[model samples]
Every structure is written in C-alpha cells, then in structure tokens.
Target: MTDSTAFDWRSFLLKWSGEWADSLPESETRDADDEAARQARWLGFPPASEERIAAMEERLGRQLPPSYREFLKVSDGWRNAGGFVWLLAGTGDARWHNNESGLADMYAEHLDEDSGPEERREADLWRRGLQLDVESDVTYVLMDPEDVDDDGEWAVYTWSSWRAEPPERHANFLAFMRDMHREFHSLGARQGDTGPVFANDTTRELDARVEEARLAALGGGWEQAEKALDEAKGYSRPRAAGLGDQIRRLLGKTYMVYFEDLVTDPRYTPELLPPLVAEHARHTNWDDATLRFQLRGADDELMSLAFETLDQVRNGTYRYTPAGPFGEAVDRARELARWGGSDAAWRTLMDALPLWEPLGPDHLAPLAWVADPVLGQLLTPERGRELLSTPRAGRTGTPPSPAANLDPGGLAWLAEPDRGNNRTSYRFVLVEGVHPEELPGRLTDAGGDGGGGMNGDADVHGADTVLNAPMTLWDARHTSTADQREFSSYDDRALVAVGRAGTDWSFAFDDRPAPFHRPRFVSPAAAAGVGTRAMVVWSGLRPGHRKPFFHLSMAEDGAERYAFTYEGGEIRRSGEIPEALEPTRFFGDLAEGAAAEAERPLLEAVTREFGASLPRHALTSGRLHTFTTRSWTRPPGQGETYTVVRRDPPPAQWTTGGHP
Candidate 1:
C-alpha cells in the first residue's frame, strides 16, 4: 500500500473534487460518501492491494504512472457516474485487456487496414497507441502511449470512432480530467442550469468580494463598500459570518485613516468631528470609556466636550474602544505615504488631504491635536521664524539654466520656509575615509581572459576594482557653469577640490525661492547647525521640460557618495542622521569603514540588483564580491562602475547570445 503521504485518492476525492461537487446544486452533484459506498458493490471493489498491483505490473512488463498507481491504491475500480464516464480496470482486468486486445476491439476497428494508403498509414499509428476504456460511450477517451514527450509523459487523445487519423490530444490524464470537468459545467450552464455542475463553493468568489470592499473603503468609497458587503452576505450565511470579521477589520482601518487625518491637519475645525466620530461609533463599539462613542449621539454640550477631549490627541491615559494604543495609526499613515508609484501610491495621501487644510499665514498656533510631537512642533509659528533665519545651501555663481523653466511645485513645496525655512534647503557633502583598500587600476584586470568584465568577485577590493573611476569634480566641462541651451552639466572640479581638502564637505540650500539654488557657504560649522549635514547636488535641469535632476541624500553614502545625479543623484538632507556617519576609511589591507546605517538604502539597492537578500555577514565576513558595468551613453570603459555582490558571482554584463 502506498503511504498516505504518497497518495490516497479517497482523501483527494473527498477534499478536492468531492468538495467541488458538494458546492454544486443537488440535481447536478453526487456525494463522495455515497459514491464510495456504491463503488464497494462492484467486483474487486475494495481497491487492488499493493501485491495485486505489483503482480499485474510484473505480467505487463511495465510500470504504471505515479498518478495512476496512486489512484488505484485508494480505489480498485470506480463506480462513478453510474459507470458511464469510464470503467477503470483493476489488476484482474488488466491481463484480460492487454492479452486479448480488448482495446483493439473497441478502438482499432477505426484503423481499417484496408483503407486508402494515406488514411491507412495514419490509422495504423492510432491503432498502435490507443488504449480504450470498456465503459466509455465515445472511443475518443483513450491514452496514447506511443505519443510521449521528452519527459516520457504519455499524451491522452480523444478520437472520432469513424476516422483513425490524428486525434485531439491532452498533455496528461490530469489535464484530460480538468477539461472534462470544465466541459461538464459548460454543458450544464448551456442547459438552463443555475450554476456550474462541477463548480466549487462560493469561497473564492466571497474572498474576492471581501477584498474589493476593503479596497473601496480604504479609498474612501465607504458607501460602495457597505453595498458590496451587503451583496456578499447573499453568497452563503456561514461564509458571510466569517467575512463579517474581515469587514469589521477593514472598517477599523478606514476609521484610522480618517482619525489620523483629523489629528494631523493644522486647519482642523470642530465641524468635521461630528460626521467622523459618529461614523466610527456606528461602525464599531470604539472608545466607549471616553466621549468618543457618546459624541456620536451627543447634542451641543456633549459634542463640545467630545471635541475638547479628542483635541488632546496624545492623551494616553484613557481606556476607550477595543482599538487601543493608537500610535500605530500614524505609523500606518506613514506606510501609506511610502507607497510611492505603486497601485495604491496616492490613495492615503488623497484620502487624508481633504480632512484638514494647511494653516494660512495668519494662523500661527501649534496644532496641539497632532499626536506626533515632532510634527506638532514643526507647525508652530516660532519654528517658522527660525527656519527663515537660516541661510540656504548651494553654489550661486551660475545663471539658472534654460531647462529650469518648470516651477517645482510639489518638489518646491517640500522646501517651504514658513513650514520650516530650513525644510526647503538641501545639502550635499563628501563622506570622508570610505574607500576600497585597493582600487582596480585597469578595467581589464577585473574581467577574466574573456576580457568582458569581472565575472563576479566577493570582496571590497574586487568591488572597488570594478567601480568606474569618477570624473573629477573640477573638470572644465563640469565647472563651466555656462548658460547652455541644454541644462546637462556637472561641476566636478569643485568636488575634486573638496575631496583634496580632506575635511568633511557638503552643499546645502533651501529651495523655497527656487527649485534649484547654489550653496551659500562651504563651512562645516554651518553644515552642522542646519539640522542635517546632508546636501542636494543638482545633476542638471532638462530644457523645456524644466525637470531638475537630483539624488536623495541619506539614500547615498560611502563609495556610493562618489555617484552623481546622472549615475544616481542626491537629495537634500532632512533631519539629523540619528548618529554621526563614519566616513569610509581607506586602509591598505584591513581597510575598514562601515557603510553608514543611513546608507542602508544604498545597500538595499545592491541587494535588489543582485535579486537576493544580502545578509550583513556576507559583507562583514569579507567574502563580498563585485561586478563592473559601463553606461552605454558614455564611451566604452569611460563610464565603468564597479558594484558590490554577495554570496554568488555577479551577473554577466553581456546581451544574450554573447553580444556585448
């Protein structure tokens, strides 16, 4: 007997196909239990024992397929479909069919050895392969052992009894059953049936409807979501009960979106509270201890007290709704904010934006309702003054390029002075000491004799060796600062000067007045006081489009710092690095400087490029690897860049078929 782990058709029928049958209308389905009992009445009904199967195989001089063998273990022969579907032969029947050519009598008659040459030739081929079921109506249902794929998986064919030529083929028995099942359902549907004869229960459909409702609610279409849930309730009472829990969870998420929006918006008003509070209470038994639930039914005085209570958004002492410790509410908002460019990219932002407007110039009070302390302080009037007093960072000698025409609205809004004068400013600086022990002098040395490139090297040295040397910051092309028709420009000479100076270097500027700004000072002390030491290095502005190129600051550090806007641009530093970033140190053998924790993003980029998780041990273990690649836009070898790899060799840099 095959172990249960191997296969048991009995369980499979009851669990999979049986379950599907149970879901169908009574008129079109059979219960598996009843089928089993009926099958027991047939001769050899207890299912062939393993010894019987083995003895049959011995006589046939061939092994049965795994799926078929597994099926026989559970059922010697099935009495399914009143025996009309097909009569499966057991061990005893196997010999009579094979030796007596029982298949030939049923299907080989179609071959007709006396047929015309062409037809006869094709018929002979079918005769050689066809294995017919004794009980099937159409000889079409048969297995063609001669028609096997490279994997030795025989194809099953359905043929017309009148013609012995090619028959329609299915890849295997499983596929044949699936198509048959589908045909059965489709036939029933066409015959005025209410549902598919072989269809599974409404679980799949129910799950889909539930997901749709949740998404609708998240996107603020609450009415549509409610309607969806009501419709879902009709699928099945039992299933609907389970879905009720999911609906509540979704409702909870929806409430949080609105709750945080009301709490954060500086232009909040008492008028918005009634609808939100009322809806939350109606949807769930939330915050019963506080006035939250009461406020839902509150008259003027009660409503006023509710407002006063909720106004203190950060109060942690109260035992309210089952949904406790609402700090995760803000976390969820931030998660939504980070959904950049995905399908739901703008969902939360759009949902929350209308809840509260920004405080106008005349409005200066801190939004005490904001539970997040950092966010609350940023909205204060005094903070706005301090931001304005700060000097912007960026070099100003060059004229604004013609390409800088587009007003950087959203991007510029990020740098507003009143919101935080320094908020609009950006900074770019040189991270000291983070260099490979030995940089590759020549590109050829990294790649093997094939001379393509380093196949893969798991070491800091290997990575640096492959890295394309950066263009000098002071190069005339980069530093010209000329008003060219195209805004494609780089000022490498200044960077080279900073690199040579040996001190920490950076550029900072608030983009309040302009989308692009020049650095006002090169002093490190000034960089230190501006809240964050990071800087934005403009790659260039595209003419007509007026699109400014940039790289996010914290996202790049160490060797990645050498990367520029064209390669991977930098963005302004926002907030302080939780800890001082250690510059990349260049030591000969034990060269040691950790990639800043702030630069984990750069590490993540490496991981993504390699298509795997890059464990910290791989890098720290000194088994890191590297691959060198060049930009197609630049001259061959000119734009060479070495990237780090871990555990495995880096992917080759050649087009398929060996074309470079």
Candidate 2:
C-alpha cells in the first residue's frame, strides 16, 4: 500500500490554485484578467477522461509523467497559472506539429534545423525533448526524455540559449515546478507585488507559540503547553491549521515525560494506558530525547502498558479510538524497532533504553510481576546498559561506526590531515564510490585553484589518498605514531582528508598529525550506514603570507580557498580570482553590505538543523589553491568512502543535485 504520506498530485493542484488565487489582489491587470478568464474556462472543462488521455498519449508517442496526468484530470490546461511556469497543456492541447497550444507543437518549433545559426544551435539539443517552458529569450526549460531515471522521470534542465555551458539540471518536472514556484514567490515578495509565501506574522507567531508549547511539554507542564497550542489555533492563517497536530504531539511528549505523575494520580489507572499510548502514537515523528530518559522512570504497570501497546501495534491488532495516533504510531514504531521480527524489535528498543532510577527494594519487588519479557529485561539496569552498548549489527553485521557517536567537542576529526606525511600522517584514502570520480576535479575547476598550479610553480600533493582511522583504532594508530619526527619545515601546501566509518564518509582536515589525540567529526547524514556525505572546514595563519586562510569542502576533494574578514555586517571574501564561494541568496551579496547579524541567523539555523557547526572564517586575503586527489581508500574494515558530496547551504542545492 502507498504510504499515507505519499505526495498526492490531485491535492497539490487544488492547493496550488486555491492558494495562488487567494494571494492575488482583487484588482486585476490585463494579464491577470486574461489569466482569470483562462482559469474559468479550464475550471469548467471536465476532468480528462481516461480515453482522451490515452488517445493523446498514442498520438504524441509518449506518456505524460504522473504529475502532469494528475494535472490534466483536474484542469485541461494550466492558464494564467504556474507562476513564471508559463503554460502546461492538457489533453486537447497536447497534440503534435502546429496543433493549437499542444506541447509537442511548442517543442517542434525548437527543432527546426533550417532556422538561423543562433536558433538552430538552440533548437538542436532540444529536438526530441519535451519543452516545459520558455520564460525568456535566453532561457528555455525542457525535459530530456533520453535522460530518464530509474523511476522513468526525465531530468529537467534550464537551457540558456546563448551560453556555451551545459544546461543546468533539475531533478524532475515536479521538482522544477516547486523550485519555480518558490523562486517566483520569493522574487515577487521581494518586489512587494506579493505577500510572504505560506507564512506571515501570524504563522511566525504561531510557530513561536508552538515552540513555547514544546518547551512546556518538555518540562512536564502539560496544561500550559495545551493552552498555548489552543491559542495558536485561533490565528486563521492557512499555515495555522496544523496547530492541532502540534498540540497532539505536545500532549504525546507530556505523557512520556510525566508518565509517573499520571500513573499515580487518583484520576487515572492502568486503563489510561490506551489513550496515553495512543497520544504518544500521534507523535511518532518526534525526536525529543528527553522523553527517552524520562521513560526509564516509569513504574512497572506503565512499562508493561507501553510494551503491550508496542506489541499490539506491531501485531496489527492495536486500535485507537476517534482515529488518534494508531495509524501513524504503528508505522513509526515498526520503523523505530526495525521490525524484522520480535528479536529485532527488542534490540531496537534496547538501543534507546535508558538507565532506570534508583528505587527501594519495596518499589523493586513489583518488577517481578511485570509480564513483558523485554520490559523485564530492561528493568535490570546493568543488562539494559550492556545490551545498548552493543546493538545488533545491521544486515552487514558491522558495528555502528564510531563516527556516529562523536560529540561536538571532537571537531578535530574534521580538521585537515597533516600531509607532511610522516608517521603522524593521517593520510587516508578515498575509496572511489563515495563520490563520483569527476567531482573533485570539477570542484577544483570551479574554485579556480589548480592548487599545484596556483602559485605558478609550487608542486602540491593533492588529497587523493587521504583516509581516516576510526576511534576504535585511533589509540593504536596514535601510540604507533607518537615517536615520528616532525618535518624540518611544514609545507605551505594545504592538506585535505576524507573521514569514514562503515558506509559513511566526510571531508576532514587536521593541521598536523599529532600522536596524542582524540578526534571528533560529524557525518552530514547523522545516521549509521545511511549518511552519504559530510563536510569540513579548516584554516590557519600562513607563515610568510601573514594572513589566515580556510579551506572548505564537502566529501568532494576540492576545497574553496579564501581569506575572510568581517567588517561590521559584511564579510570580505577575497583570494581566488574567480570568487570560490557562491554568494548566499539569503543575505544577498555580503560585500554589498548587510548588518552583521543578518548572516548569523542563517548560519545558526543551519547549525541547529544539520549540526554543521563549522568554524567561522574572518578574512585576514591570500593566494588561493584548490587541491584534489585521484586515488584514496582505507583498508576494508577501516571505513567506507561516500560517493557523493554533501552540498553546502543545506537543502536547496543538495536536493536539486540529486544527492539524498
């Protein structure tokens, strides 16, 4: 069965039209008026009959992607819609050649080999493609049928008619639509022609209110949390409709945190289990760790109830009254327990088992009466700790990577390795698969630092064979390397390292190989065997250069070389001739001037969301050098190299770049 959370094309079209219309001002321009008339016409058109869609597909010799088909079933054509997306044809308008506003006809115009030089060159590449839109004379978006993925979705690209460069890619039609929608709304909002997208003062206020509720819920102040959540619902903004869900999740946290208080209260008894369990079921998505710790304090009866609820959920017999959390909880609990079977379930639970509170013998006597075997096993504090210490190895039977358990202080693991390759050499190798072989080279070119070629004649060692040792083997490696002699003079050349454990890989750097050491690193994935990439930033003051330089890179080997210094709200980034770092759209061009606090929030928000607490670089200007390695790998049991680089600035680039 398709998960309930699966994207619904029909719902999206409805919401898109409804929200777009709602946001538009009542007074319409000629364009808006024309669009409204087209909308009215399309709205009155019957949903695409299956027969019509089939006939259209037969004539076009291609099947429309599911999203487009769904759009057809709602409206025959997108008129005055899709923001800057221009037009999307429905069945009757989807014919070939010169037929009406048909999609094929639009694309066919771009395939003319007899056109002028510029037009012919522009049309050649898109001859057999699906033209999505032509927003400007220079820009045309198209879906290349030849570049379809495993899922049968074509890769969409923005073709710049005059640029000799390759077309910039988007993942698919749906993704391209989403990006265009956001881009249009963002630009429109900036120009004062539109209000904030899906959020305004009311939504922000509601979010703040929910954050307050979340805090209260965490502190066991259930009443206060519930009240704040209620207040949030009074705001009639479209986004506030989810306030009730927020309240339910808070209530779930309340149950977990104050389980003991509720269990012993005169108003409740063992019968309260169903509702309590169900309430928590609604919050299956919550990642609050405090609840996990508090759950250990639960009494025997409460523990038994939780286990019972878990069992019922796993067995498919659990039912929630009034359609509460049962559905979500069942799926969530199965996911948490890695529900291969009872054993896997038990082990999964144990991985998160907390230390039980100290209790008198009288209180402990009742634990024997508990019927859930897993619960009883967990009650023995030592046993629970032991079980948690060594979770069941995954399908590969490899223990969870030590890198997964790194603390924030262990940031040293992300430092550039001392490439002064001595025994202190943290020289690790990149095992090809973690990133496409072309990545390091491409980044090097983009940064415009041929590294070895940067200083005209300096021969630099690229970071191709860098590999990191896991914490388990760190002590041994450290002790063995303690006696290594330091090089007479450290090379000015920058060193780049890739850290890995199990299937996880990340960019890491260390100033020099230090024998006595502890290392810390963060995997961008933050999960065991699932994270595909990581990033690292390292810098120092150069001896003769007299300026501080930092190198920033992802799992991709090339690093952005820059010298940064903050002047009030502006960060002056200078070094590489081509400007290595892309200007962040969030704050515009920093050099153009901004309040110092403007970029702080963006960085802080990223840190909160992704734990990317990289060291901030304050320019002190320098010669830039970008280095990369063509070879790298650690021994097999040592660590697994990632094949993709985790894109910077969080989600937007990463999502469009096709890295999960």
The lDDT, on a scale of 0 to 1, for candidate 1 is: 0.34
Q: Per model, how many backbone clashes are there?
A: 55, 30
Against the true structure, what is each candidate's TM-score?
Answer: 0.26, 0.30
Using TM-score as the measure, the top candidate is: 2
Candidate 2 lDDT over residue span 1-660, tens digit each:
222124565565554455455455555554754466435533224588888888988877898765556556656665433344456556765433222224344444666556676444334445566654533444556666666666666667665546666566777766766565545444433334444345544346656876666444333343565577556544332222232332342222333333332333323323334434444454663543433344544666656666677555333244322112322332332332211122233343433323221122111111111112112111233322233233221211223322121122222333323234222222222222343222234223233332222222222333232121111122223432344233211112223322221222222233243221111222211111122333333323122222222322333233332323333333445444223233243335533323332333433432443343221110000011123332122212323222222334344232112113
| Residue-wise C-alpha lDDT for candidate 1, range 44-161, written one tens digit per residue | 2576789988997787666665555666776665433222345545566543223133444444466554667655533444455535355565544555555565544556656555
Tell me the whole-model lDDT of each prediction, alpha carbons only: 0.34, 0.37
Q: What is candidate 1's CA lDDT for residue 509?
A: 20
Output the lDDT of residue 256, model 1. Answer: 33
Candidate 2: lDDT of 274?
41
Highest-lDDT candidate: 2
